[model samples]
Target: MRTHESGRLVQAALAAITAAAAFGVTACGSDDSASSSSSAEKPAATSTPAAESGKITADSANKGKSIKLGSKNFTESIIIADIYGQALQKAGFTVKYDLNLGLEDVANKAVEDGDIDGYPEYTGTALTALLGVDPSDVPKDEDAAYQEAKKLYKSKFGFTALPQTPFTDSNSLGMTKQKAAELGNPKTISDLKGKSQNLTIAASAECFKRTDCALGFRKVYGLKFKKEIKIDVAQRHEVILKKKADLTVPFTTDGAIAANKEVILKDDKQLFPPYNVTFVLSQKAADKLGPAGQKVIETVQKGLTTPVMSELNSRVDLDKEKPEDVAAEYLKDYL
Candidate 1:
């Protein structure tokens, strides 16, 4: 009873309706009903959608959504958190910060308790500290470690770990250039084996207990220091510079290393696990962020290679720039 033109018109109308329904389903879902598996499996997009036009612009879908971002009590963590927060803000999400949230356990609890929607975390820390995986059992391969941590996070806590950043900030033995030269320029931790007996090493008390720290130096590299001084992580570079300690445990990406103030002794035996950065978000928050928001988070991190991150840290630690300001400057290109 219908003409050919009428049938085509009906089909078009139905297609429009179907498209609208699909979008509506995505926009309105119960907080708990969202599945993290899809988001987790989706590879991070290499390009920023909002920046395609040469400037970041707000998405209508993200305008009303809010995300609470948190970070551990460290300069690098805070800088990373600020980067994520500012990028989300540009995408029209109301980002609330809960920075300096203490240690890994405290930050984990904050995310679990909904005190924060998410935070940037190291894959090694998440595997060992949060998931109870032994550090030795943690995968040495970066992608493999990230996947294991992501799967465990979802199963154990119903959280989602977004794509990892390009950089990996693992613990390493560092000493001043002068001290290294004095030690005959030991190029690797193994080179310190026989010489360690005369060197005074310093690190946080926890480092003495971790297999990846003083324990690893002793076991894996057969290095035993003359004296192990318990010092805070903040004083790592200072201790070496002040000559209080001949060597100190520092993160590979420490600003001091970037500034050439300290030399990282290579882990020839690979004692430390990969500590790549991943943003851990609640299932509910991940669902609300959806694919577009997740892409924004991933895109901004694409530029954060080890050297780039080290420089960013140097800006804050050496240049004394605020993390927020440093983040803003870094995001300018994306904006």
Candidate 2:
């Protein structure tokens, strides 16, 4: 539980963010009342247990006796990485971490080279970004996905993918609070049908090109934007604030959206793939953790959900809480 102490510091920061996220967001949405309250509200839905999703294999037992944890450069990766590190630590293995690693390619190289164990990745991101496969047209759920990804990973390299969860933090659509009200779109993708085409959008070149972001929304919702503006990634808030873009792409769990009070549009057509955060374990490290790794897997398997992950992300990115601290505090809440 020593990790808990570290986590509490994160929780305090998250609590502060939860209390003060207004400074970071651009406030997009038609539902101003609901959007305004999302930050202050303690989650509203009742918890429903998710079906089992991960495993600690004999291969893993013999392999992950001691593991290195890796993470991408993003805040969510940092938090998830800290959780993975603490879980391995509690399971009785010594963990070394290499957080803030660049991306899947870098993390994959590190894991393959035995520099780090494994890290979290999204199903869509791996298939679309890393592997050059199109997940946009596939069924928008997780069944057979782990198996598909495992085959690709093992065949391409010696790595392994653990069970995936329902925790999704995918790209979303957002507008200024006033803009949302002006648009009058609500509750579904079709709501914007005749209008979105006139609104200018701003996002990453990737987001603009990706199926889930622009294409999917257009196809599924029968809507098209009048103009699309490409900007550097992660700078949507600034663009929206300056009115450079009429609408922008946002992440559902992103803290900046909530902090700025940006009104997020609903994806009624379910155009996005479910990118439940998953543990992509390095084969080398899995061998060192032994049976204790299974316990760690179980602990993680029991908690992560869309709502849970969304809040955690909001805390770290918007609230200014450290990812490591948020992970630790989250473990305390569920453990």
Query: Which candidate wins on TM-score?
Result: 1
Q: Give residue 202's error in model 1 in angstroms.
A: 1.5
C-alpha RMSD of candidate 2: 11.8
Cα lDDT tens digits, model 1, 1-335, are: 11112234334433433221110001111111111101111112123245343234567667667788888867788888878877777666776766777778888999999988998999998888789888789999999999999999999999999999978999988899899889999899989878889999999887787776677788777887899999867788888888999998888887677565678888899889999999999999999999878987776776676766776777667666677766766665222
Question: How well does candidate 2 score on lDDT at residue 182?
Answer: 80
TM-score: model 1 vs. ground truth:
0.81
The runs of at least 3 residues in candidate 2 whose Cα sits more than 4 Å from the true structure, single-residue gaps closed, are: 1-66, 190-194, 215-227, 231-233
Per-model TM-score on C-alpha atoms: 0.81, 0.71
lDDT of 1 at 321: 65
* Clash count of each predicted structure: 0, 27
Which residue window of length 10 is worst by lDDT in model 1? 21-30
Lowest summed lDDT across 10 adjacent residues in model 2 is found at 21-30
Residue-level lDDT for 254 in candidate 1? 79
